[model samples]
Target: MKKLLFGAAPLSSRAADVTWLLFRLHLGLSIAIGAGWSKLVNLTTATEAEKMVGGAGSPPDWFVQQVADLGFTLPSAYFWAVLAVWGEFAGGLLVALGLGTRLAAFQLAVQFLVIAFFWYDKPEPLLGMYYQQLLFWAFVLVTGVGGGRYSADYWIWKRATARLNPPAARAATLPAIPVAG
Candidate 1:
């Protein structure tokens, strides 16, 4: 007989479910603090936008310098600044809300990778922001199991599924339409 793993099924299920709930909340909040909050604050201030590019732009000096490092100038840098802020702020909000966790995580991960390779190029072992990015990347990669019971993603999925394949009784309640000639 195969050994029954995880001791008991029900206990294991509850444990997993609780763990997912906590994980989703913590990870989502972390993302919000890391990016969303700053972007949100920046949104309220004109100078913050200028500060972004360190030249009357919202991009940070380093961010703008990176653009110049790659020979991109002016409006391109500004555009990229906007993209970065949105990637962080909007993506973070969605992840925190569990409204589009996977998409947000993926977008953030891509942005981090680009920053790591082109913007900072941190030394081996990766400390500071690089380390944080690494953790965020790993978390998203390891926990790509949609969303938990406490997540909006879960409810949305359930609702969509019910709508797509409703029960027979529910379906029967619909009024018959007239046939076209």
Candidate 2:
């Protein structure tokens, strides 16, 4: 679990790392700001226009009903709707920051998996499923790769390991070289 949470990026080429970083930034921001921030703010400041699109002060009656339609019992439906909203908002933010990335990506993977497979009566089934599947796979990729060397996980790991094996300690452990006579 610690490894999963704090692992560095794979030891691939610099290009690979850079590419991963770019992908991470794009997907993370898309999920965080594009999809999450609005709904999160809607939790307290949903406008009438927002209401029509499933945003309201409390997870939107329409959204809760949709959750219920997914076979969740009412009240419980409310609970689940709220959880999903929070997950999108917080999970996206964590992913964007590359902090606790694997866990956040895993949660998002589960959410997108459900959205792709379980969402009912999608307006454009193929198109919608494509989008959800793309997101699901992208999140799965992040979960597998973890936060790379450029991520907060790497920074934290470096700090923790440095404390455990400081430079002075390392120098002390090394044998001195013999002088040439």
Candidate 3:
């Protein structure tokens, strides 16, 4: 019974590890290709974005004017738009590579926040902003978990530790042999 249980344990653990790797790959690809790609491809114009933010409507105009009235310089609408696009672009690439996931997620989160802030008057324009936040937080969570089990980080760490401890490496490489009386 013990042998059976022990034999199954490693397989179960390996399956879980593979699942985690798949999750990271899915998340990274979605962020890089689905979300980031769209932004990067459409960063040049802001006419549509400005209209969505209520810039042409009385409610958004009043909101913008109120901020401007307070002596705060209203940011050029395009500035915020471009910032979001580039932040998601670069951050998503970094996260996809597993090189700097935390920093990339942080930048993406901030970009979402900025977009949310500017478009608060037009909830329709900010409909999917929270989803971006959720994705960013998910990335942050995975970053804290240290790049999952089958990552470049794991491979590099294993190689470095093996190089630093040759005796341990040699012991690990030796095959087990059964001794008979």
- Among the numbered candidates, top TM-score falls to 2
**lDDT at position 22, candidate 3:** 71
lDDT string, candidate 3, 1-181, tens digits: 2221111111146677677667767777776655555445432244445433332212233434544543556675444444544565566666555554445656665655544444355444434567655664676565455444465555555566557789877888899888997
Backbone clash pairs in model 2 (N, Cα, C under 3 Å; residues 3+ apart or in different chains), count:
0
- Of 2 and 3, the candidate ranking higher by lDDT: 2
The residue pairs that clash in candidate 2, if any, are none
RMSD of each: 11.4, 4.1, 11.2
Report the lDDT tens digits of candidate 1 across residue range 72-140.
686787677667766776776665666666666777777766665555445344565666567557545
* Model 3 lDDT-worst window of ten: 2-11
Stretches of model 2 off by over 4 angstroms after superposition:
43-57, 121-128
Q: Is candidate 1 or candidate 2 better by lDDT?
A: 2
Residues 75-179, candidate 2: write the lDDT tens digits: 799998888877877888788778999999999999888888787665454675788889999999899888887788888878888888999999999999999
> What TM-score does candidate 2 reach?
0.82
Off by over 4 Å in 3: 1-12, 43-83, 113-130, 168-181
Residues forming the 10-long window of minimal summed lDDT in candidate 2? 48-57
For each candidate, the alpha-carbon lDDT, in order, equals 0.59, 0.79, 0.53
